[model samples]
Target: MLLGMRDDEEMGRITLAQVAERAGVSISTVSKVLNGRQDVAAPTRVKVERLLEAHAYRRTTRSAREAPLIEIVFHELESIWAMELIRGVENVAKAHNAGVVLTESGTRHAPGPEWMEAMLQRRPLGVVLVFSTLPTEVKQQLRSRSIPFVIIDPAGDPDPDVPSVGSANWNGGLAATRHLIEHGHRRIGIVTGPEDMLCSRARLDGYRSAMTMAGLEVDPDLILFGDFHVEGGYDRATEMLSRPHPPTAIFAGSDLQALGVLEAARAHGLRVPQDLSVVGYDDVSIARWASPALTTVHQPLRRMAEEATQMLMRLRAEEPVSTRLELATSLIVRKSTASAPTGSPAGRGGARS
Candidate 1:
């Protein structure tokens, strides 16, 4: 009605009457602003801003973009093993023009002065924790500050509200275990990750599920829990093999752990596949080069790292995303696994009766 608009409500879309009623402003006041009147006071300007935001106004080219600062906290930065993950995360952050600050918490000095104050003072766009187990107090502090976060290998439900992105750890574990089962190996065993890691438990659950699905009853004695590194894998594998009727097939929860298992098997005069078939989660680069070409489940490390970066950027923009992001997992077959060894269990065990 004001500017060559149609008289019908639907023809030209929402009318001033509708807008005025929704905004709780007088029709005359709306007219003054529409007609380029300069008589509005400070309160009216504030009201207009609120209305625009409530209506979900899309930002046009002129809106200034805020430069976001992101923090990546790690428990251990000195390990060469963690470098690949760091590279993936840092590369993604740089591509988005976001500032990345790296800090090692729970280090020598007990995270004394510097770490506690970092998140609260800067109020970063989001925090990315790379396979670091954060203490409960630290988690609560972040939540209290209303900070968003993504954890790579966190121990528990990251936060009821914040979104998290990581590879399908449980499924990865299942896939690795299933591959061993498919190759006619029973006596399947596991060398797990740290007890505190949700990933460790998830993988263990997957192993149990896979065995159950195969109609095989799991022997609690066959389960060996350990750390994520190669040494931990070796130690746990040794314990499993020491048992009288040790596992003929072993599933190591991580690639590093798998390497250790391989070594332990060799030390006991056992040949891979011929002696003990091995399957490993996390098909890291070294998995292929390991003796007998270690068969493993491939986790998308770079992809997961990239996703964490992207999620942080979107959250900073107050954008929408899935609360629980899960990635795909697949099993990769290699020489490390083969037909069940002769004289071992069969169908429910390895080769023989």
Candidate 2:
């Protein structure tokens, strides 16, 4: 439709009204008939179809396409954080006067060598993978085909040699947990990310490291697993809270999980910070307004994304690039955490360690 297409000034572009006038029919009649609106008379549909072919107006939009297109492929389209990641990719791509072809992997049909071959044949400016959902074989196929690409959340050994970027999630977990510990809390709990995700594993390691460093006993019973989602967090939180001796300070690996924990807290009639201290990773926008402002670890989302895509552009320009980029993570201390209750499992009631 001309409404969503490009046009040339010199062509004296035809208008729908003109088409209607030329066709000797009312504007609505032409639109309904041409659009197959189902409300048009059978004879009117035939006349509009004929007139459309005669005008050769099929290609309604026109534009001077100058920039080259770069393919930005994501592992999955439905991930909660993919949109922000995409916006970051688009920011750099558009700034450099390049186009972006967004596609995905991990569906009913897995990617294969043939798909990689087709993508290589196009010779895109570069490939930016938001995440690696494809199998190792597919990745190797892309590499062997000499395709240029960078990994954001790279999957297994996702070309340790190529430029890769992501949140410093391990440090995020450390910071989140350390904040609770520093506030005189000992019974700290952790909700881990997916077992297969290196990010989640790193975060879990950080949590254990922080606990070990503080000389606090890491109770395996206090740790749970979630898939980095609100619902997962909700389920895990409910399950953990059902325990006879629940933790005094719970650290969720993501903001959504933290939200789920908040709901779970309400379900159990536990007030945040008053009865339980909570912390979350990923200081998303909603973290600010949660019942008690969330004390979360902040992932440098905009900067990380900007830097990653910018690195992709640099690679396209034949510039030498580093293979690994580690961004810093920080704690955004808010209202959700407080000193451990006098009788809480944290050290308040225990003998000196």
Candidate with maximal TM-score: 2
lDDT of 2 by residue, 271-320 (tens): 78787888988787778889898998888765666778887677545576
lDDT of 1 by residue, 1-353 (tens): 01112233444334445546766888666444333245756577446434433442222211122236677777787643356666667887788776777788765213333565645445566687764345554554454333557776433345444466666878887888788788777889898888867788998999999999999989999898887788998889988887777888899978888899998888777788787898887777788888789888887776766787787666556677676676787888888888877663732232222
Segments in model 1 whose C-alpha atoms lie over 4 Å from true places:
1-69, 78-81, 107-113, 116-125, 131-148, 154-157, 346-353
Give all candidates' CA lDDT scores: 0.68, 0.70
Q: How well does candidate 1 match the true structure in TM-score terms?
A: 0.70
Q: Ten residues in a row with the worst lDDT in model 1?
A: 57-66
Candidate with best lDDT? 2
Candidate 2, residue 219: lDDT: 93
* Per-residue lDDT of 254 in model 1: 80
